[model samples]
Target: MARVLSLVAAAGAATLAAAANPHAAMGGYQPATNVIEHSQIVYDIEAIQTALSADDFTEAKNIYMNGKYSCKSTSNMRNLQGFVKQATYDAKLNGTAFVDAFVDGDGPSYGPIPGSGGRLMLSPTFWDDFLLGALDGTGDFLGMSTAIRKVAINKGVLGVSTLYAAYEMESAIGKKYDDNSADASGAPHAWDEGWAFLYGSHPADDGKYSAWEFSKKRDLDFAYNSSAQAVEGATVATDMLLKYFLHGLRASRSGGVLADMVAARNNIYRMLALSSIRAALKYAEKAQNPYNEEYHMEAYVYFLVAANWVEQAYAGAGTNVLALLDFKKTEAQLSSNLYCAVKTELVPSYQPLGLDCAKVGVLKGHDDTLDDNCNAPACPATQTLPTGLDSYVPDVTTTVGS
Candidate 1:
């Protein structure tokens, strides 16, 4: 298992390195689950540790050809679409100035995410949506995920890396957000930042913000924050990349459906995390400032509702199954989490979109009591209206004290 895992990771690293040239020779090739596996990616890591190792142009070109096929999966394309579109959106609105705002001032929003034909983009939503689609079944998140992972992994191994290199004198620093900046202009956040941004920490826990505004970025931490979120769009991404690196190696040698399934789940869960965070952030944004502990607690319900949908998708990732096909324990988990803070005071009406909060839970008003299970018969905001189709919760600002 260890050897197989190593191979999968190495293949992706190698593929990332070999992406520059269109033609490259691979030593051993076996069709693994409809995707071409690369042995050289793992095995040849020692021979080539730096980009300079590919001394000859011919050496560089050979492995590059195989890298293209790695990211050509349909699953990867949607990722390309989500990420590219989001990046275009980000760039259009924020410009490249904030592109690499995650790690330091020089960071970007996402990663060297591969698009069609191995073109890389640094958009966080690319992988976020790919992971979400894996659970929902409306899209081919699996194929695109594998393709991108494989190529990126392979390139890293060959030392002629595609992603880690510099572009426009920038090393492509990823963007991270301070606890604030969950959204801009009070727009709902659609990725994982919402999760940590909203429910991840209590407002009083940290003192970095002027007001508890989601539009502002957080510069500190309180609870389970990740480098991905810490850097702007930096949280939860490396985990996916690392999972892909590990899974590719396992699938390479073991050649089992389980490894591939894990790889698939990694992508899905990774995105689900992002989606949940985005929703929570949006909810917090709408909740506005001067929010008390009750405000955050109530806001948490919408975020968890979003989480429930995301978890449904992540839980089913092990099988190439549709997450929304049926509600299961994970949804219950979401409900339970919601109960902790949200159901107590849900306002009413709900919406379901990519991480919509309504379907999960809602706050009626200040009477939401965690001490009492969400069995509040007269509770106005709380309802488990069957999980099918998507709708928006009515604007409960007046009722919920928004």
Candidate 2:
């Protein structure tokens, strides 16, 4: 009996230690070996960005479309929601913001725009537009099915597949709000509450998102180093995210397939899949403590970005179809619906009065100041300036005679 008791105690101690260190149980998040698809998409986006920079919108659109079609119609990346479920469980058990913990110390990896930069900052505009594309089914909006199909065919190793899961998530969540409401209706409103658990607060208790957390902790067994250059695959990642919104704004305003707008939409979905996979692999490595509430909260919260992004892609698909068919009147109606969606569903409400159908397109520009200045209450200038706005620098101006 004494020996048995000792064995039992030893086992319990081992279990406790393992529970304390999340890295020990999952063997750390090993990055996928086959990143060719991700690499290809990155290259394709770089080309698109170059075209946009050169004002070759037509070429950029074509490239974007081709990248969209590059994935197969089916995915081998199956049972991806298992990760989400597990992450949710982990968050319930631990309070960590596992994936987004990087953004705080790392700075804005996602953008010049406010919510686009960090994990906790939610974007209802992004949510509204994505649902429009997914439900419309004009093209591969989330790019999940195609990506999974390709992954299955190529037998590429994936740590977790996010796109398909995102599709199902939007569908399931959107169903809750299918009935038209006085506030935001159906898809738009449903997508708005995805990360409700972490709403208002910074993703981490420290009030930071830890953008470079993975890279800094790369020596750990679970951390995967993405060999690609650029922060999150270059500034192009951030730019692509911005372009998707830009394209939607332009499409809503133009009311016609002005250029390769379809391609741009598709390309953005492709980028979404690639980035999600890269980030997931990095985060999975550090998801060690199941009892740590923050860990679980963050793990669950991390997936919301992809969820919200794909919703935008899905919604964009629908909106693009309208542009393609030249349904000016109907398109205008949907844009109005989108304005209401943000107003009602977004907490702290998206304040830009110009986001309505007639004004949004006009409001879209390279200058993020529009978003910064146009919010309902308006973001403070101190919060919106470029990185070096305050530091001392040599003034270039010269006086000929003082």
Candidate 3:
């Protein structure tokens, strides 16, 4: 009887240990080798960026619509393609003609407008009549011109990558783990797809033109001290995301608890969300004292992207935040008070998801004078800036002897 009691106690202890560390009981289970196979899409995105930067709209449109790795070909990204098309049409109809004529040496005929290093300059009415004009309507002015292609295209790619990756990870979390087969329908394949979408075929943390690059940019933007210098070791968002991806992959393959995988997935979603939110915040600060038309357009587009993602991913938790962003307002009409309210809403809304507001940091280039209006009241229906006021021109002035 004594021997039997001792044996029973040992068995109970072993059961408890197995319950604590589930993987301990799965003998001889090897983690599936990590395999990511999605570099083509990254390449396509890079090509698009290059073309847009050179003002080669033809090349950009071709790559976006017909590249081998084009998002248009992917069922999951067709909506994003639609957005690109809309932006292209608006830009062509409104701003492209002026830009083309300027680049072709007709800028002198349009008046002594500002140019960025004598490269490209639209007509003086470019901002008021085209860029900001589109912004005043409907508030969807991303990809309206070469200057802001990065804000719309690159950010859009990252948004879709992280969003669908989260979806894939969640689906894999629910399915049974298949250690033997690496087929598409298996958990391992889904996990790999999730990894591929964010990192592509590149080694961890070394990827470019995807979520990795954008996340790093946002980290640097948000890691600045009050002196406007980047603080070392302050950029943890990207690292945290990488850790979650690696750990989640391990959990999915090593017979670990599904709960661990779920935690990793949730954290990834939160970090990605933070990346966009941080970007919006940075641009909002820039919008207060916009150096040029680019800054204002960027601020609105980033806010639009971030707000839309939050609403969709968090089940409309960002509805109020979106309203505060108020895309219909012109660049000058976007008050600092409204941005402050956005920060306030974001902090508490994301707190449950482990948002450390300190990591987001304070807004750069903040101006007290701009915050005097507390409510960010609605502006007049037709908001247009005077000609040449927001144009980017060379700082050449004719001085008369005093």
Best-fitting candidate, measured by lDDT?
3
Instruction: Give all TM-scores, in the order shown.
Output: 0.22, 0.22, 0.58
TM-score of candidate 1 on Cα atoms, chains taken together: 0.22
Cα lDDT computed for each candidate against the true fold = 0.25, 0.25, 0.46
Model 3, 56-134: lDDT tens digits are 7566556555553523233543222332233532443222212222222322221211222222222322222332233
Identify the leading candidate in terms of TM-score: 3
RMSD of each: 23.3, 23.8, 21.4
List model 2 lDDT by residue over 1-402, tens digit each. 011122223323543321231111101111111111221232333344455456554554455334431222244221212223334433421211222221122211211112232233232222223322322322334443322222221111121222222232232222322332111233222222221111111112210112112112222211222442222212233333334423422222212232222333333433443233223322322222222222222222333334333223233322222222221122233322232222222212112110121111111112233234333333212211111111111111111110
Clashes of each: 98, 46, 1
Q: State, as a TM-score between 0 and 1, how close model 2 is to the true structure.
A: 0.22
For model 1, state the Cα shift of residue 25 in Å: 18
Better of 1 and 2 by TM-score: 1
